[model samples]
Target: MCQTRTVGEFAVSAGDYSAVVVSQGAGLREVRHAGRLLTESPPVRPDEKPPLSAGLVLAPWPNRTADGRFVFDGVEHHLDITEKDRNNANHGFVRTVEWSLYDATERSVTLGVPIGRHPGWPFDLTLVVDYTVDAATGLTVTSTVTNSGDVRAPFALGFHTFVRAGDAPVDDCTLTLSAAKTLPLDPERQLPQGDPVPVDDTDGDFRSGRALAGVWLDTPFTDFADTDGRHVTTLTDPDGRATELWTDTGFRWAQVFTADPDHDQGFPGRGRAVAVEPMTAPPNALASGDDLIVLEPGQTWSGEWGLRHRDSAA
Candidate 1:
């Protein structure tokens, strides 16, 4: 049996797509397109959490590190080993915590959580994630994080969204991204170990359309520039139907991942879907402090990203 929850004009299709919309707000939630799922949703089973699909916000930090430790303010901070293979904490809090629906209407709903100081992260902050849908457009998400601690806090944000071309297998789909450089990683643990490299002639290059069927990716790319600072990354099926992801200037890094059967849903012909991740910082920014955004006491940071459907004709 399927469970449904309604909050004002927003409808949550639980177990299928935990999407929320504010008919009044400029956002959409749990949106499905073509016969394939677009955003990640919470799991229906009592024991299973939401799958890392659809749209998930990662903050304070994104990606992984060589070790589970980073140095901040001359103090060594160690994070929980969320990914044992790399021995680093990937993403941030709230992947498990159920978000509070603070505001809901016909078109949008606001979900929020506060990250208190902990062993790994010793900064106090309040984070809010807003998911909205516009009938004329598709899904739009906005994330805001404010520093509530006494001291300045260094952080970054990212959204992990797994996308597929409707019923098409990943191999048959093509990917196009507007990036010039990519961060190289250590193969064994998949951690950044050196300087950024040009994406030319490498598997990391998506400047030109590339088939993703059998490719394995866990890399971060940079150098995405646009006139209005809103660049796009797209995935298109052989038939030409496509999904386009747009991000603002705050998002300088984009990580693309192709899952293997051992770790993903193992969809018959499609081992896993393609992920168009918009990140504010590169991997391991806590230690390197490169491209890290620091918020002064009582300061706030906000940004938006979204997905739009494009037809072959356009």
Candidate 2:
């Protein structure tokens, strides 16, 4: 049986939101919107858990590399092969670890986890994740990592959120991303090879709002517009309800995935969900040295991302 714990609650003029942090692997239990469910949590089917939400932090790395080995500081390091497809470790350490609750209040909750040196990653680090919700903004999550070891630590961070636009089928939804470049990948291993290509004249473009129905994407994109120091992306449904995602400067890349596990629904698509991921680095950062983030000893790094809903017709 799954266990659940209430962490915090925020009341807004639009509606009320609540946070539930679970003890089972310290996963986010729930993130409700206006008393309505905005995120799926506990009792979630196995397949529904991959796109974590209500703000969870992915550390050490974000996406996959061809192999589990990389060279750092003249040393070749091998990471545990977590993703069998490319024989690489995807994401970071905290996904499977249990976090300790550091603080909790009516509107926010803070949790912490320590990443210790191991065979895959030999760095001692401390990570903290804080989640909040506002009436104006649906949910905001912030994360900070501190290098507690003597040596400098190399890593990256990101969040994976699967958005469901009310009763709208994904095929009818429109995606708007202000990204200029899309990373080209090796067909066989799905690893980054050539330089990033412009979204124009390619199936990767979403700048002009594309319908999600016929779109298939599993690509990494960067060169996003720095909207006066803010980075934002939006997904709108036919009903005029929109889900907006905003992140900080450190998040330079975004990955959009559309999968349809239910084909019998006559949707003509795979899974009817849109995952808007925010990452500090691109895929295979450890090997490409493109998404690498260095943390000096005793130094801490922190950033925030959030989701807000708007009813244009209202």
Candidate 3:
């Protein structure tokens, strides 16, 4: 009689870590460490949409496609514009759609969906988002995309999650990112406007870690100095407790945004909150063909990004 829950919540736990992966968009809903919140999640009614894309999967292409138009493989296509104010196609088709439950285990849950929602995106691809969390290691999310179509398909992947360090005010938290440069964005459309800039004196220069009090950004940082296989970023509260987010080589870019409470659009928090997003490519990858992953028929692209909660707050 009643419609299905907007996003079915699948709960998984192991040791001191627990996570809830929703069926909608195969997105993450909640993640906790030792009963303390590790990621920021807004309260939602069963019929409500997930706010601010807090834990949605960004795929096919991340960010926006200007004018919802692009030419690829000598073919011209126009996507259905989702961001009318900017006249662009924002994110992709996966966020608000329902995903099939692929598998579930004590510590992990996998959800999947086939992409090709619009006539503009005519290639068929399957996506599997696997989420795993444990007390010893926190949470690890692996997104595997397979091309199941006759022709090659362009693709990229990203995950949006807001993190906090033990209930600390976001303004007092310090961020350290393992990035060497920042891509400038157009104020009007939030699209790439110029070449990447060095992080030296810019707000992007959080290499040594800096207070986020005065910085307001929705910028992409690239040129990761990943000495090891993993690129890392850290958000530390004033008292020294921190959360570490890391991405594997498949993910070469990260976007950091400062969400304001004065605006209080969707996110449910008192003060400023930081969204550290793991992205395979920067914005407008679909249009620029920059760092886009091309998956031939039967080919797949696998990438991982995760968070580790340090319990020093105890």
Candidate 4:
């Protein structure tokens, strides 16, 4: 029997926008604009994992930690190395876990999950994610995290969602990012190397918007433009139809991934999508203490991110 039948599913609709939120990890299952799919998340099956962490929330920590080990305060803590080949702890372990639907309505839903003290991560936390759709603003996600443990906790966040403009393949689309720098990764571990490098005049540059045709990208970008205190990225079709993702002051990084079919790593729907992830910190943050967020007991941290769409005609 398919276990998906037992999982909770919630939907919100307003105007031309509709979204499906799943119970597992409070991940988003799908989003559509005027009956057209806007994201890459397909309906999840009972025994299957989401394709490319689609519509999933990466929390507690984002990206990977080398060797799954980090020295916090004065103690050495070890996390499970989920990426065996790279010997690193990949995205946080909540995607497969279930979250409780605390509230739901026709245009919004709120899901909550509790994190207990575990061997790898010893901090206790209670996270609530609220997904809402607007008639004019499209979809907005607000996440709140409260430290429930007696001691302080280290935390970071990332959101995984791929956007598409119409049915065209990603190679025909243009990507415009409001970032000035790119984090270079080590060839072997694929982890961030030194400080970020300027993207201006380089292949990494996409300031004025660039066609993704032959560009291979799997990079973390920062130095985001603070226009009106918001950072934005857009993916557009040749005809001008577009989808825009915006992050608030809390997000300091954005990782862009092009799902190439030729890559050795298997990716569902490869060569068809591009993921523009809003992240609070970059890879190996847990070990570097760079841009990491630390919360004391009873403290709460919150942030927001969202997406909007525009038609070719207007």
lDDT of 4: 0.85
Candidate 3 residue lDDT tens string, 1-314: 11223457778888888887788777777788787677886677523556778888887887888988877898888888999999999889898888887887878888899996576999899999989987688899988999999998899888888877767878888998979999999988999998889998865788999998867888999998875899988888877878888899888888898888665552564557788888898998888888999999999889888888774563
lDDT of 3: 0.83
Index of the highest-lDDT prediction: 4
Once fitted onto the true fold, the runs of candidate 3 whose alpha carbons sit more than 4 angstroms away are: 1-7, 263-266, 311-314
The TM-score that candidate 2 achieves is 0.87
Q: Report how far off residue 311 is in candidate 2 (Å).
A: 1.9
Our model 1 lands, by Cα RMSD against the true structure, at: 4.8
Return the TM-score for each candidate structure.
Answer: 0.86, 0.87, 0.94, 0.95
- Tens digit of per-residue lDDT, candidate 1, span 285-311: 888988998889899999888776778
Per-candidate Cα lDDT values, in order, are 0.71, 0.70, 0.83, 0.85
Model 4, range 161-255, lDDT digits (tens) per residue? 88877677788899999899999998678798999999988998899999998777789999999978789888898888888889997999998
The model with the greater lDDT, 2 or 3, is 3
lDDT-best of 1 and 3: 3
Question: Which residue window of length 10 is worst by lDDT in model 4?
Answer: 1-10
- The per-candidate count of clashes, in order, stands at 19, 5, 0, 0
What local lDDT does model 4 show for residue 212? Answer: 93
Superposition error at 117 for model 4 (Å): 1.8
Q: RMSDs, each prediction?
A: 4.8, 4.2, 3.1, 2.8
Candidate ranking (lDDT, best to worst): 4, 3, 1, 2
